[model samples]
Target: MSREAAAPGLGHNGGPPLEDPDPDAGYRAYVWRRAHRKAWKTPPPEIALRRLARAEELGMSYKAYTLEILERGRYL
Candidate 1:
């Protein structure tokens, strides 16, 4: 059997094919990823240390605590 037939879900490079084949969709995804990453920029060191300590005390991860703050604009 040929390589394509051997791998049912894989593309030419043996990876999953793009779910959305439109070039504009790819560009929009890239932009959304960049903006999402930018939204998670590191806070000032003092604030970051405080948040980390609070997160630990609350038995939560730094990311989870921060995401909560970003979504609700409040501390837990």
Candidate 2:
């Protein structure tokens, strides 16, 4: 075969072509979600109250603080 024909995926795109966007994408997503649930735990109400207080002290709303924790696993 010609070089171009042999090199079906070689181009500016810069990687092997996707035969499937995801072969086991569903399984992978399921595993990731399971792990995430295992890693994240809800804090007790008192801890939540302290976090709210700290958020107020930092001039941030409680909602913003909780969202930050959910996104990053900690408040910045």
Candidate 3:
């Protein structure tokens, strides 16, 4: 049998698995994650209190309400 048939796990090319073809993909993903977390940082105490009140009135959890605002850029 050929090398490819000998090691099916190495893929059809018979090379190591190409889980991440792009070398810069990891750094880009890390930057994206950092930005995403920054966007969801805790609001100020007064704003948090207001959002909590509004969330309670709307019968939604604080996290759900906040996620709605973050994703839709609007108050619900």
- Give me candidate 1's TM-score against the actual structure: 0.52
- Write model 3 residue lDDT over 1-76, tens digit each, in one string: 8986676663367667758589998999999999899878988999999999999999998999999998898888
Model 2: per-residue Cα lDDT over 1-76, one tens digit each: 7987766564456665667487799999999999777645567899879988999998998778877877887667
Best by the lDDT measure: 3
Worst 10 residues of 3 by lDDT: 6-15
The TM-scores of all predictions, comma-separated, are 0.52, 0.48, 0.67
Using alpha carbons, what is the TM-score of model 3? Answer: 0.67
Better of 2 and 3 by TM-score: 3
Whole-model lDDT per candidate: 0.87, 0.78, 0.88
Alpha-carbon deviation at 16 in model 1, angstroms: 22
**lDDT-sorted candidate list, best first:** 3, 1, 2
Q: Cα miss at 58, model 2 (Å)? A: 1.0
Error of 1 at 59 (Å): 1.3
* Model 3 deviation from native, Cα RMSD in Å: 5.3
Model 3: lDDT to the true structure? 0.88
